[model samples]
Target: MSLTDDAHLPPGLALAWGAPAKSNRLGRKPTQSVEQIVDAALELADADGFAALSMPKLAQKIGLTANAIYRYVRSRDELLVLIGDAAWGAPPDRVADAPDWRAAAAIWTQAMVDRCDVHPWLCDLPIRGAPMTPNLLGWAEAILKVLTGAGLSPSEGLACALLLDGYARRIASARRDVRDSATTSVQPAAVTRFLEPRLQELGYSILASMMAGNEYSDEIHDADVTFGLDRILDGIDVLITQKRSSV
Candidate 1:
């Protein structure tokens, strides 16, 4: 069975995929507003990595006691979910009216990457559950609509969404690393020295070669996102063509 079908997927993911609802109980009364807490947490995350985001630190930064913050969010993981959705909430207004589904998807992918560019810490958060919040669900719905027009099967559409998001997050991580190295004036050779061994192990020696000389220029501008999106769309286009020919 696919990993998507694994029993270990998070509860929210199961629910989003039409699994049984686990609970209907009401949540606790809020003392701190969700917006206030999320705004403070995002500030901390943008300044520091996610590891720096403990409940105590967030509380201190927000001028509240650590325990007081709990009235808003149950845990740091929950805060992460909020921040991820919030950062992605500002997806470009243009995605809905691109010239074609492929063009729309490419825009969608870049918008996601742009969010990560501002919130580098978001690149590290794990997507343990399916989307439940409005911002996240809206992005998902947008991608689903684009994919539906591309003629992907339901499962293909879902997988394409996951793959595009995953690529965007990975690019965000790479952007962070590249920026840090540049700020420190670390030599490309030094980066290659450390990463080359790992690259070799992964059989990505070609990437190691590119990193050695800074050959991977920033001229690419979201091209990583566009390239992966186009490849997926090309596959879907084949399916669309087949359906048309059969008619």
Candidate 2:
């Protein structure tokens, strides 16, 4: 649903959009604001990952009883929504002097990647829906302006935005997974050695080749992310060209 659909918004969504503050009667007086609760939740998530952000744990972190935490947020889910909004903060500044939309779009996408790098836990948060939060919508608006200004239709521009966003999330998730796996006992070299013989026996020549070339190494580096992003942008350029040619 649209963020403006205030009449029937979920409690978490309403709070996120700054709906009238709800009265809290459970405690003597709340020492923490909703922003403070969200801030503490973000800090907890950053330090210990998203899995560690239960109500009891977070309440302990902020020196509140588990029930006292409910004074600010109705439930852990609402707190998660608030934490995500806080983590996103604000959109990156627009590139005013950029000569083309592609450059501007690249800047936008890179800003998202950098944000993910800072809060890698963001990659762990499941995307329940579209950009309802303010910062997220701001990011979307920035990119849409670039794409539509480049002569794409609104629908086309939105599609490209989704494409770029998916690419960034996938790359970030892959990198996070690789980093997490590195902490375990299994090593990439050992896995490659074990799989090579089986892959060759199964006649998966391409898989064997990649294994031999170290392409299956469990590391997602900056160059790999850049290559994928450039390819996506290149595809969008082709679409823009086709649209222009037909006009």
Worst 10 residues of 2 by lDDT: 1-10
Question: lDDT values of the candidates?
Answer: 0.71, 0.82
Could you tell me which residue pairs clash in candidate 1? none
TM-score of 2: 0.85
**lDDT (tens digit, per residue) of candidate 2 on 108-211:** 78778778878888887878887887778888888888999888998999999999988887787777776766766777788888999999999999999999
Task: Report how far residue 12 has shifted in candidate 1, in Å.
Answer: 9.9
Candidate closest to the true structure, highest lDDT: 2
For residue 156, what is the lDDT in candidate 1?
73
lDDT of 2: 0.82
Candidate 1 off by > 4 Å? 1-31, 183-229
Off by over 4 Å in 2: 1-7, 94-97, 183-216
Clashing pairs in 2: none
